[model samples]
Target: MAHPDARGNPCSSSSLPAREAAEQALWRLMSFYDTPLADLDAAMAADPAWALPHVMKAGFLLSLTEPTLAREADAHLSHARALARHATPRERAHLQAVQLVLEGRWHAACRVWDELLIEHPRDALALQWVQLWDFYRGDAHGLRARPARVLPAWDEADPLYAHVLALHAFGLEENNLYPQAEEAGRRALASNPRVPWAVHAVAHVMEMQGRFEEGSAWLRQHQAQWAEGNGFAGHLWWHKSLFRLEALDIKGVLRLVDAHLSGDALQITLQRVDAAALLWRLHLLGEDVSAHAAGVLADWALGEGCAGDYAFNDVHAVATMVAAGAHGQAEGWVARCAERALGAEDARRTNHLMAREVGLPLMRGLLAFSRGDADEAVDLIYPVRSGAQRFGGSHAQRDLIDQTLLAAAALGQRRALGRALVNERCMAKPVTPLTRHWLEKLALPEAAQA
Candidate 1:
């Protein structure tokens, strides 16, 4: 049994000096987002049981690193919950909220956000999450509505405002409203050079117009900016992955996945998990993800205590199994841990086929195309609606949904689908490089004419 702190929170380390340092680290994080995570990490290393720092650490991973480590971050969240200051219900709720995100519970995550928002209407992070949570629930109206309430109080001078604005732009872009989407994206990124989501939003502008080279070149240069010195959101690599695939340069996708995702943390962190999921999807698309990727996912699975989600984790689980080429092994794990893959619509459902349904179909569609089943490939494409940007992930991870469907149209030479996909992208920033390249295979005369 762990010792409790003065507030009766479960304590991880018995050392007074270490606990004191971690305490300071926690205060620092809440006060400013710019502190070196390395310092907080040092505090954690000294006393792993210190709950607040871990909560902040989870925030760091989600913001500054990969978005995938929600599970491992939840381990810290678990301790935070167990050790939470019961008197401070709001903070306790925040701990539970962090756990909810780790669990991939979109609705529950939203409920948590709503509760927090009701209590602290000015909580910017909660407001940002409300929109993102609505995104994953696949409700465009909800996505737009939440932000509308907050944008009045939100300042473009604040970087997070632009980050949130990027999501609004993405929803508009996804819904096929180009001019407004472009303007929103431009405003978001203009507020902060670090707003890659918005930058990618603008890149969508370039992509829709058929300037594949221009769009690709533009986002390519912005990669370092997104992955460094800002609150982390690197799943944009998934967007880039689609671009590389569009180019039909398998090596380009592989190298990018490797370069961006090659290294991972010792413990399963969110950043590493985020990297793993994207790269694993790429690996399934014929890139070689490192052999140890499966081992890493396994480690994350072992570090349980996450609450809320079945969609995100199940998606990653399927990707891990698919990437390892261990369907039989995965089926066994699925049977044992069978509760993870059910859809949100079913009360009894546990897991979701997010990767299997959206991401894997593309990989499988490519495989089917290779095997001369273009019709079947097209059949696998699903009608997609994003509930929240980070419900499963942001516009970046789910962009594959569009690319996959486009691949279907391109493969089958379905002129209507191809044109529709192009038109849809045209309303936003544009298609990403991956979709453009994929569409090129169909060789639309209009594309050439443009």
Candidate 2:
């Protein structure tokens, strides 16, 4: 996509409309995730000097599915950034935030996300920020609290308020308030049947209630519209990825990534909640997601001369450490958390956030399990105490927490922990092969006396 700003008659040469176009392009660009590259190309061809599109296209190229073509897009994005003095505020904000996320500057993104969340409380596009940044940092209490402050009239303001409902519901579920969570999710779906997060919550309720077929079937029914509309097709299965971790459709998840990650010079921006969650799924499935997503994630995590607060910034970092098997990195992440814990306004609040906020504490638990420190592992996530249903995260997201805890219980010889997790009290159904096999082999009579 290439264009020149030639709006004025050279004789009079007033760069007014050209400047206007640049400004318009920026907002359009920020709000324009998931639209196909070809269409964006057509837009650029219609007006070559549009700075925002070029900036966005370049961002997409960096995360391209295909190397050769993405390089071409990169050339154009480089050109767009070069011409950015003429870009609009919205375009600049998005481009900058996008860069932050890509760079993994968690602290920066944390500050920026809070501002954007407040500024665009109901922006259809700001949800992207909510995913990549805010999703990772805060706790369950944070997730469920003060949504009203963000959008007090949220229900009537945007068609996408269903998403907030989904968030609210998931937040409640993470805290073990299943009944409340289910109701929130159902209300969200009721308002907008298309809200994927709402559907995600309902699915969780179904899973806990043992309506597997019904839960499974809803995803199949809405997968297409949800994908095309949100650019986060994988999220449909993301919530279900928990109990069915063994039954996860790895190929399906990859296909969704493949469909979205095409390396066409212009990248299709998708919903942050959808795309980032899909990336996590891909990571869990043991795919080489890091290679393609590292830059894209870094772009979001780092932000441009600013900060953001999306939760996935931290989640993705931990997921990456897991994928890369970087033990030291995990330790450092904990060290950082410890630092944040010290200065945090409320330590209890932060811990509560950790319980469901991407389940990072759970990751620590798993890491402990890996090193044969089962008790430490279990202790790390003990706050995720059974029966505290408000551990608000997607069911699939919460599964990782369960997985780590179950493993820790068995290995640490915490029979009560093991039985509590595998038994019907915690999980509506009995243990699956993966959980059962792993737990049984942990040998509680052995090293674990805690």
Whole-model lDDT values for every prediction: 0.54, 0.50
TM-score per prediction, in order, is 0.60, 0.52
Query: Clashes in each model (backbone N, CA, C under 3 Å)?
Result: 38, 55
lDDT of 2 by residue, 331-432 (tens): 666555545534544333433244343345655664675467879977877775452234334445545556556656655667686765665432565333
Candidate 2 — which residues are off by over 4 angstroms?
1-36, 54-81, 138-147, 150-181, 205-214, 220-231, 238-395, 416-450
Per-residue lDDT value at 187 in model 2: 80
C-alpha RMSD between model 1 and the true structure? 7.8
Score candidate 2 by lDDT: 0.50
lDDT of 1 by residue, 1-450 (tens): 444443334444676766566545443333233454666677667766555566656654543223445556766676676656432455556566656655545567677877776655545546655665565555566665565555666555543567668767776765556788889987876776566667767765554455556556767777667655433334555456555555556787667656664454223344455655565545534455546466556555432323123344444554555565656544444443334333334343212444334433443443454345666656654433332233345454555455545655665656577677776665654454444554465676656543
RMSD of 2: 10.3
Best by lDDT: 1
